[model samples]
Target: MPRRVSLPSADDLFRPTSPDGSDRSPGEAAERPAEQAVDQPADQPVHGARPAPRRPSGRVRHDEKMTVYVTSEELHDLEQARLTLRRTGLTVDRGRLVRAAIALALAGYEQDGEDSALVQRLRDA
Candidate 1:
């Protein structure tokens, strides 16, 4: 008789990782349609008014990859910030934090152009 291998069922394989039922793979969010993932009113105008605040894609899908090199001191600072936020019960990863920071900088730049903090910092650097 051949030895039969028992494989886990699809349900078991795809079961949520968290007990509270909020577990989701990071890439899963990328699969969602923007209309479904983001809550926008049907009546809301798509443009003209000041754009909505640029919110970081927290726990959502990030399909693109970006590589940034940071100095040791900068890395330490990032870890420190992550730890500090963890202490406050935010529990965010470095990537998510970096995304949020990028969103903030981009928003600032969009609103301020050459007068933005990002441009000023780059100039100083």
Candidate 2:
């Protein structure tokens, strides 16, 4: 005859701290009820358990478009770049590519500050 062994389920493996469980270290159980945890900061008093607040739904209006002009050579290069990205299993359109490039250029400009020392010297004439 073979002896039977019980296996722990995922929920049992991740059970929350029990107030009277001997497995928990001394004085280490959560001092406040789970619901009160959010309401009271670590240094503050824990009031009676309260319901968690609902977060606002992330909905916004996107109601604007602008026209941009590009040279024939530039447009050709953008199309080639898009095709190359698709070959590499990344799907992106010309507008996304242009937006990403503009973002990178703006980040570089910001790193060199809006009123840089070179610009100041050039303007002082």
Candidate 3:
């Protein structure tokens, strides 16, 4: 007789992750983390007034996957950046670095609109 292996069900694999209601109030789904929501620099806009620039969900196990192909030059640059960060005592894998960079570009676009570096670059491209 062969032994069987147990595998996760579809529901288990695709569980609700965004502010899972287990510990949070219903309204918390619409709110940012307390620290982010609480501290409003006078220079910065309020969270609600403009949808708070989407921040990176750091250090969590991501279930979804996205495949991106880059040139050898780009790959070399990314590796160099990873090494530089390691030298500075910050260790993060390439995926985490890419995600952080994406978050930064999105946040810049959201906050600065047409004037953002992301938007300017896209327009230039």
Top candidate when judged by lDDT against the true structure? 1
* Regions of model 2 farther than 4 Å from truth: 1-62, 114-125
Clashes per model (N, Cα, C within 3 A): 0, 0, 0
User: Model 3 lDDT vs. the true structure?
Assistant: 0.78
Q: CA lDDT of each candidate?
A: 0.82, 0.58, 0.78
**Superposition TM-score, candidate 2 onto the true structure:** 0.41
What's the CA error at residue 24 for candidate 2, in Å?
47
Query: Which ten contiguous residues of candidate 3 have the minimum total lDDT?
Result: 20-29
lDDT tens per residue, model 3, 1-125: 99999999998975655654233344564676766556555436766675656767666656578999999999999999999999999999999899999989988887888999998998898
Instruction: Score every model by TM-score.
Output: 0.66, 0.41, 0.60
Is candidate 1 or 3 superior in TM-score? Answer: 1
